[model samples]
Target: MRYRDENKVLAIREAAIDMVASDGLENFGINRLAKAAGVSPATIYIYYKDKEDLLTSISIEEGVKMTRATLKGFDPNMSFKEGLWVQWQNRAAFSLDNHKSAEFFEQLRNSTYKDKMLETINDEFRKNMGNFVENAIERGEIERMPLEVYWSVAFAPLYSLIRFHNEGKSLGGRKFKFSEKIMKETFDCVLKGLTK
Candidate 1:
């Protein structure tokens, strides 16, 4: 039995993410991915069974990575403001540093694979996030609201800013650059709206 090459695997993964992000999933295929990764289609088969398997596997791996990055140093028991600040810092750092992976996930979330991907997300991530929201509501640190509303208010602005940063321009063709100051100011507004 031949052993799989880690370098090739990494190359395939990166190429797959870039392809999917740039060309959309409809245009992704093993042949195209093999060419992009400089590997043969047989090599991809060594690791993944088929297109669905490959896409799902990569999405699961990326989701775990994102979960870990988002949850670093976070605790459900912390005050809502403190916990959310940590989340903001971690998420902003991860999304900025891994913009392609972030974009891939954004696309995945809207695709037919979304349900399957969500089913595979880390259990700890779900638990901690759920507990954090519950604790916040119980402690009166944040208003009781639907999950959709909470996510929209808590994270939509951060994502919008990240999108602007990635594009290098914002509204009115203004040059855009990401800064901690901007993130903090945006977080403050989100925090105030979330809390009483």
Candidate 2:
């Protein structure tokens, strides 16, 4: 509440993310988030006209941030296998390192998402993903599967890994930290099956 103006807005967003990650979006009433953010509910009203407006803003902001983070360290010109490997590693590490963002995405995966918010969120990631795959296929570096089919195969494995870790699954009695080894293995298996 006492932070600088920009910082307060960020705190509101962060608090909203935490609330949704912890309690699910259905529980994200403005009063609840404002209290969690240590601001008056009216303060939230000042920044957002309503709860849906707040959610739309959060979804767009977080979605773009996640998309940017996912693309970090990915080489657009690498060999198909190498690009896939790096992408997997980057994507998993981004999700695991930023659990709230990961959880926020997981929540968005369900169809219960409000239509307008979901459209904005999906558009952010889907465009990058579509372009990446389309470019690879156009160059004959990757398989010719339909875009949606390719997306499903590419994202499914990583989704499982993230979900398992989020659910507190461990390996060999140790917690399953997202690692290069896991990313490499996942990428190898997926790309091998998808490539000519």
lDDT agreement of model 1 with the native: 0.92
Q: List the residue pairs that clash in candidate 1.
A: none
Model 2: colliding residue pairs: none
Query: Residue-wise lDDT of candidate 2 within 1-196, one digit each (tens)?
Result: 6334787798899998888877887777988888899988877887889987787788877777767777777656566776777677777777777899667756656635546546664664666566667778888977677767887887788877787678777655566765567866887788777887
Q: Give Cα distance to truth, residue 60, candidate 1, Å.
A: 0.7
Top candidate, metric lDDT: 1
Best by TM-score: 1
Off by more than 4 A, model 1:
none
Q: List candidate 2 stretches off by more than 4 Å.
A: 1-4, 111-114, 121-128, 170-175
User: Deviation in angstroms for 125 in model 2?
Assistant: 5.8
lDDT (Cα atoms) of all candidates against the true structure: 0.92, 0.75
Per-candidate TM-scores read 0.96, 0.81
